[model samples]
Target: MHCSVVADFFSILKKKKKNVFFCYAVLPQNIGTLHGLFLFFISLFPFTLILTTDNNYLFTKKKAKKFSFLVVWVQFFLARKKISNSTESIMDNAPAPSVYIKTSPRDSEVEKAQNINSATPFVTLPSLPVPISRGQCVVYDQEVLICGGLYTRDCYSYHVLEKKYKKICSYPKDVKLRGHSVVKRVNSNTNDTMLLSFGGYKNEKKHTLTMKYVSVWNGEKQTSNCNQWLPLMDKNEDKPIIIGGDEDDYDGMRSVIGGSNNHLLFITYRPKNIDVFNLDTFQYVNRGILPSDNWIYFHGFVSKTKSELTSTSTEANEKKSEMILFQRKTGLAIEYDEDSKSFDFRKLSVFDDMAPLSEYAHVCINDTILFFGGHGGPKLGVSKAIHKYSLKENTWVKFEHNLSTPLSDCVSVLSEDNTYVHILGGFNDHRDEMTIHVKTKATDWMDEKEKEKMQIYNREKELEKEKNRKKLQASHFFCCCLFFYLCCL
Candidate 1:
C-alpha cells in the first residue's frame, strides 16, 4: 500500500513539475517509515536542496536528468506568468501613443493662409514740427529727439508712448549741424548719459568735424530738455579736434559705428578712413582704412559680444566683443575681431545687384538689419523698397510692403523694444514721419501681387508730381513770353 502511495506521489510530481527536489530528497530519507514519508511528500513545499552524497550514489543518470528538467521548467513557467501580468497591467493603465498624419495643402490655399497672416510693414505717423532733411534722430526714455537739420537749430522731442511732439531746447545758433551722426554715451566715472553729435555738413558746404557732448541724463533730469551742448575740447591743445579737411579728401558724410568705454569709432567718406575718438583723453586717432573708394552712402555698425550669442551657460560668460560694419553701397560687411584685432570683410551676395543705391536709412536691431527707402537705385527718384538682412542666415529678403511715402536720406531710429523703426525727416516736399512694424517672421518677399500694388502706387504719385511740374513749367513759359512781349512793346 505504501509503495503504491509513493508511486502515485511521484506521478503527481511529474505532472506538476514543482517541488520535485524537496519531495525527492525528503522521501528517500523517510522511505523506511510509510507515515513519515507520506507526510513529507504531502507537504512538498518548493525549496532548494544540496545533496551531500555522490551523484552516482544518490540517483542514476535518468533520475538526475528528470530532476534538473523539472526545476528549470517550473522556474520558466513562474517567470513567464509574472512577466505576462506586468505587461497586462501596464497596457491597461497607460495612455495610448499619439499618431500624426501629414498632408500638403494646395498652392492657392497656402497663399490664402499667408495673406491672412501677412501685414503691411509701414504705417504713416504724424508729421514733424517742420520739414527737415538729413537730421539727427535718437531715442531716449521712449521719446525720439530730433535736432538740427535744413539750416535750422530747432530741436523737438516726440513721445512715442503719448504719440505727441514737443519742442525741446535747440543747439546754439552758432553750432549748425545737419547730416551729422549722433550717438548716446555714458560716462563711466560720473555714470552720466550724454549725447555726442559729430562730423556733419554744416553751413551747406562746410564739413564740421567738431563734436558736441550734451548731458541727456545727469541723474537729475529724465530728458535732455534744458541741457547745454558742451564742445568736446582737447585737453592739451585746448581746441576742437578738426576732423573735416579738404572737401575732396573728407566730404564729412560720416556715420557713427560703435564705441567702447574708452573710444568711439566713426567712418568718413571721400578719404574713406575709420576714425577713433578717445573718450578718456578727448583726442582723435585713425584706426583703419576702408576698402572702397566710393563714399559709404549707407552704413550701419553694431557690436555683439560672444556672451550675448552663446547658448551654453558655461561659455556664455565670455567678454569678447565683435564690431560689424555694413557698407550699403558696396554691399561689404566687415567684422572686427576684438581678440585678433583684425577685420574680416565678407561680400554679401544678395546685395550685389542693389549696391548702386545710396542715401538709404538703415538700423541694426538684434540680428536683423533693415534698409528703408533711398535714392540712386534702379528705381530712380525716391525708392519705396524695404530690404532686410538677417545676420544668422547671412541672407537678404526684400519686403513686399513699401513705405507710405517714397523717401530718401531719412534718419531712422529703432524703438526701445526694437519692434518699431521710426523713420523721420527724409528728403520730401513735406516732413513726414513713418513707423515700420518689423515682422518677426515674414511670409513673402516681393510677391507678384505686392509688386503690382507698389507699381500702381508709384505710378499715381508720379502722375501727380508730373502734373505739378507741367503746370510750373507752363507758368514760367508764360511769364517769359509776357516779359518778352512787354519789352518788345
Candidate 2:
C-alpha cells in the first residue's frame, strides 16, 4: 500500500510544478484536508525505494498489495461544494487513498490530449458468477470457461454474446485448486472436443490431491451436472505431479510449470526432464529430461494467429505453432519441428522494456500481445501497466494502465470473433481475497496483421454457425414430413 501511495504522490508531484510548493504545507483548518495529508505521510513509511525517472515518468520497486492506496487531492481554495465535485475529488473508479489528478493551471492542447488518453475508459462486462481469483479462464468457442479459484468450488461458463453466465458444476467433494491447467483435448467425440483440468498449487487439502482423478468437461453439453464430468484416474506414484506440480501446460500436453505440489504455486525451475502422458491410453509412453535460465518468475503465450491456424491451414505456416516464453531477464522462443516431432528452442534477441513479467495475464490480437498486471518485483507488488508486445517485432512497444490498483493472478481470453479481449479475476498482492475485476475492450488496439487474420477467422466462424443453423432447420423439416406421412398411412 505504501508503495502505491508513494508512487501516486510522485506522479502527482511531477505532473505539475504548481503542486510542488504545496507539497510540504499542512492544512489544519479543514479536518478532511488534514486527514488526506495524514494518509499521504503514512504512505511514505512502508516503502522500499529505488525509483527511476525519465521525463517525469516514475518507476517504483516497492512490492506488496499490488497497486493500492491512491492519494488524490485538489485545489484547496475551491469552495467545499466545488471540492466535492467529481473533477476535484477522487476518481469514481479508483479506490482508496484518493488522488485527484491536478494539471498545470494553464493547460495546453497536447497536455489535454495526453490527459484524455490517460483516462481511457476500461471495458465493462457483466458481473462474474462470483468474485474469483487464482483461477483459470479458457476461451472455449464463444464462451469462457472459468474454473476454481480461492474460496470457490464451483465452475461457470460465461457466454460472450448473451453477456451472462451459468454454473457449470463443481469439483467433487472438497476438491479446490487455485492454480490448475485447463486445456482442450486434442481428439474427442464427434459432437465437440472436451476440456481437461488437472494439477494445481495447494488447493484445500493438499494431501487429497492426486493423479487419481482428472476432471473432464463436455463442451457440447448444456446442463450442469457433476455426472457430466468423467473421472480420469489411473492411480500411480506419478500422482498428477512430476518434479512437484504446477498448472502450466507443456506444448499443450501436460500440466506442470515451476508451480508445484504442496500449494507451491510458482517455482522457478524449468527442468530438462520430460514425460509424455497419452490422453487416449492414459499412460506415460515415453520420458525425457528440459532449460537453464534464471528468472524469478516467467510467462508463456502464443500469438492469436498460432491458435487460429491448423497445420494445413496455410502453406506459409511451416512450423506447426510457436510459444514465446520470457523470464525476468531473457526470453526464449519454442517452436515445434514437424519433421522431427520435437520442439526447437532459441533465445529471443530483444529485452522487455516493461517491468519484469511474472504471473501476468495476456491476450494476443493479431501478432501483438497485450500483457496485463503481474508481479512487479521481488517485493511481489502488482503492476498496473497494460503492456503491448508485438510478435513480429519481438519487442515490448506500448503500455496502458487501469484506473484503479492493478491485479495479479488475473487471466485473459479473446472473443471468438476477435472483436474484444477480456481480462478477468485477480487478487491483490497483499490480500487473500479475490478482486472482482473484469474488463472488455474492442480490438481497436490490435495491429493490422492481427486484424486481417482475425477477420478471416470471424468469417469462418460465421459460416460455420450458418451451416449449423441450416442443418437444424433441415432436420426439423424432415421430422415434420415423417409425421405427416405416418398420419396419411
Candidate 3:
C-alpha cells in the first residue's frame, strides 16, 4: 500500500511536467513529518498536486490539517527566499513616505510638491444661511449648533461630517444672540448634554442683550428633523437665570473656564467677574471680580497648573499656582493668577512690532494659540495674516499665508484631533466657511542642521532605489531562465 501511494504521488508530480529539483529545493526540510499525510492526501485526491505553486498551495481546512506541517514549512521557505531577494529592491524602488521635513529634491528634474501656504491657510466651505458675523457655535457630536448671529432667531445645526446644514429649533421668541459664548455642558444628574448660550447682543443696533438660555434636544422625544429649545431654570427660583444681565454688552468676550466637581466657572466682559454655576443645582453665584481693566472684547480662559492645586495654605504661595487667566490681543497677553487674584500684563515679546489686532477668530490648539484674520488699523485693517503664538517657546511666528478673505468676528473651532480648524460666518459679506488644515507642528519648521540631515537622508534613499532596480532586474532574469528550464524539462 505504501509503495503504491509513493508511486502514485510521483506519477502525479511527474504528470505536471514541473521542475522537480526546483520543488525539492523550495520544500521545507521538515517535509519528513508531512510525508505520510502527503501520501495519504495524494491517494485521496490525485488532483491536489496541481494546486502547488512556487510560493503557495491551496487546500481546504480538512486537507490543510492533514498537510499542516508541510504547509508551514513551504510557507517558511518561500517567505524567507522572497524576503531575502526583495528587501533591498523594494526599499529602493518604492516611493518614500511623506515626512514633515524640509529638503530640496536632489534631482533638479524632479518637481517638488507645493508647500501649503501657511498665510491664507483657510480653504473655503459652503456659505451659511445668511451673511452672518459674530455668531456663536457649539460643537455637539458631529454637528455644530449655530444660533442667532444675523440679528435673527435663525438657529441651524451644521453636520460637520456630511457638510450639510439643517435648521433646528429656533431660539426662544425673545432671545436673539450674537457674539455669545456657547458651551455644551452635561447634566450630571440625568447625564444629558445641554447647549448653553450666554451673553450676546440682541440686534443689529447692539442695544438688546441676551443673557443666558439652555437648549436641550431629545432625539427620542422629538423627530429627527426638529429639536426643541427649552429654557434652563434655576432649581430654587423656578426661573431662568440671567447671566451678565440685559445691560452688559458682553458680546465676543464671555469665556467658560474651569469648575470643580459640578460647578462651572464663567468669565464675562463689562463686569469682568467670574460666575460659578452649579450644574447639579442649576444655581449661579458670583465668585471673584477680575481686574478692573478695560476687559472689553478680550479673550479669557482658565488654565490650570499643578502648583495651583498644591499651594493651598497661603495667598502668597497660591500666586505660584498654575491656575491662570489667559487673555490675548495682537501684541499683548494678560495672565491672571486664579489663586492670588492678581493680573500680570506682558507685551508679547514677539510680533510686538506688528499692528494691534482685535475682533479676530482665535482658537487654542495643543500648546499654540492661533490668531486668524482680525481688524487692525489702516495699514493692517481686516488683516489676513495667521499668527501662531507658541506657548512653550513664548514666541510668535507669523505665517506667510493669509486667510482667503480678510475677516473679523469669525467663529473658529478646532477639530477634536486638532488636525483642522473650521472658521464660520465672519465679517465678510458672504457667509463663507473655511477650514485650515493644521499639519506642520511648531518644531517642524526646520533649522539649518535639520535641513542638512533631511538632504542627506533623501540622497541615501536615491542610492538605495538604484541598488533595488538592479536587484529586481536580476530577479526577473533568473525567474525567466527558471521558467524556460522547467518548460524544457
Candidate 4:
C-alpha cells in the first residue's frame, strides 16, 4: 500500500516539473500537524525511489516517524527563502516620487550675499483631483482626510505610500463648505479612524458652527459614493445626539494645537480664543483668550497620545504640544496651554531669531516639524522657503531644497512610517491654485546626495568664473599692444 502511495506522489511531483518548491508553498496554512508530517515523509526522494523499485522492501514505522521530524525545518526553510526574495524584489522596485513644479530660480550671487537660508528637501507627487485651500484636515494612520474647502464639496484622502489623492465621498448635501474644523476622535474602539467635523460656512453664507452635534465619518465605510454626514451619538443613547452650535461660536478656520485623548485644543482667529472640546462629553471644557486678535495663522504638532489603559488618567499621562502661532508682518507669537488655559510669549529663544512668516504648510516627521512655503509679502504674498524645528535638539534649520515655487494655503501630512510627507493643494502669489503634491526628505542618504550635488554646482560656477577672468586678461593685453603699435606707426 505504501509503495502504491509513493508511486502516486512521485507521479504528481514529476508532472509539476521543476516547480517543487512552489507546490510546497501552496500548501494550506491550516494543515493538521499529523497530516502534514505524513505528506512530508512521502516527499523524500530516496524512500520514494526505494518503494518504486522494490515492492517487497519492508518499510518500518519507526523510520517513517523519525524522517517526519525533519519536515517542519525543511518546510520553514523553503517558505522563508521564497518570501524573503519576493519582499526584497518589491522593495527594490518601489516608486520614488519626484518634483513636478519648476522652482523659482535664485541667483547664486544674491543667495550668497544675503546669507539667506535654503528651503527644505521635497519631492512632488500626483496633484489633487481639484485645487483647494483654507480647508480642515487631520492625520489618521496612512492617510490625511481633507474634509471640505471653500466653495467645493469634494473631500479627499491623500495616501502617503501610494503618493496619490482619492476623492472619497463629498460633503453631504448640495451646500459647499469652507473654513471648517476637523479632528480625529481619540480612544476610538473601531479599527477605522473616526473623525468629527464642525464649523464651516455652508453655501458660503450660513455658518455650521460648534461641535454640539458634529458630522462623523468612519474611515472604513467613507467611500467615494458615500454622502452621509451622520451626527455624533450620545454614549448612553441609541439615538443620534444633535451637535449644538453656540450663538457666539465664530465661523472660520480653526488651528488644532494639541489635546488629550478626551479633549481637543484649537486656537480660533478673529476672536483669538483658545478652546478645548471634550470628546466624551461633546462640549467645550475650557476656553482661554489670546492677547492679539490678529489673523496670524498657527502651525503645530500633537504628540500621539497613548491608547493603552493605565492606572493614571489619560490626560495626566499625556503631554500637550506647543503651538507656533505668529504674525507675519510683525514677528510676534503666542503659545497657549490647554491644561492651565493660559497664554504667553512663544519660546523666545526659538522665535526671537526666526523670520516672520504666515500661511505656511507644516507637517511632523519623527521628532521634527517641517514648515513649508507661506505668505511672502504684503498682499497675495507667498514664500518658497522650508523651515525645520527639531523637537529633541530644540534647534531650527533652513535647508536649501524647497518647493518648486512660492506656496501658501496648502495642507501637509506625514506618512505612518515617518518615511514621506505629502503637501496637498495650496495657492501661489498669482492666486493660482497649486494642486500639487510634495514629499519631505526622510533619510540620511538623501541628505548626503543633496549636499554632494550642491558642492558640484558651486565648483562648476567657480571654474566658469576663472575661465572668464583669464579671457578678459588676454583681451586687455591685446588692446594695450594694439594701441602701442598704432602709436609707433
Least accurate stretch of 10 residues (summed lDDT) in model 4?
49-58
> What is the overall TM-score of model 4 with all chains considered together?
0.56
Better of 2 and 3 by TM-score: 2
How does each model score on lDDT?
0.50, 0.48, 0.49, 0.49
Off by over 4 Å in 1: 1-118, 200-226, 235-252, 257-262, 298-329, 337-342, 350-353, 377-379, 429-489
RMSD in angstroms, candidate 1? 33.7
After aligning candidate 2 to the native by TM-score, how far in Å is the CA of 114 from where it should be? Answer: 24
- Count of steric clashes across candidates, in order: 0, 17, 10, 9
Which one wins on lDDT? 1
Clash pairs, model 1 backbone: none
**Model 1 lDDT tens row, 360-437:** 777765555677777765546677678877666677777677776677777777664333567876764233533332
Ranking of candidates on lDDT, top first: 1, 4, 3, 2
User: Which has the better TM-score: candidate 1, or candidate 3?
Assistant: 1
Which pairs of residues collide in model 4?
98-124, 103-404, 118-399, 119-399, 119-401, 212-243, 212-244, 213-243, 213-244
Encode model 2's per-residue lDDT on 172-207: one tens digit a residue: 664546444555532211324455665434222321
User: Better model by TM-score, 3 or 4?
Assistant: 4
List the candidate numbers ranked by TM-score, top first.
2, 4, 1, 3
Q: What lDDT score is found at residue 486 in candidate 4?
A: 43
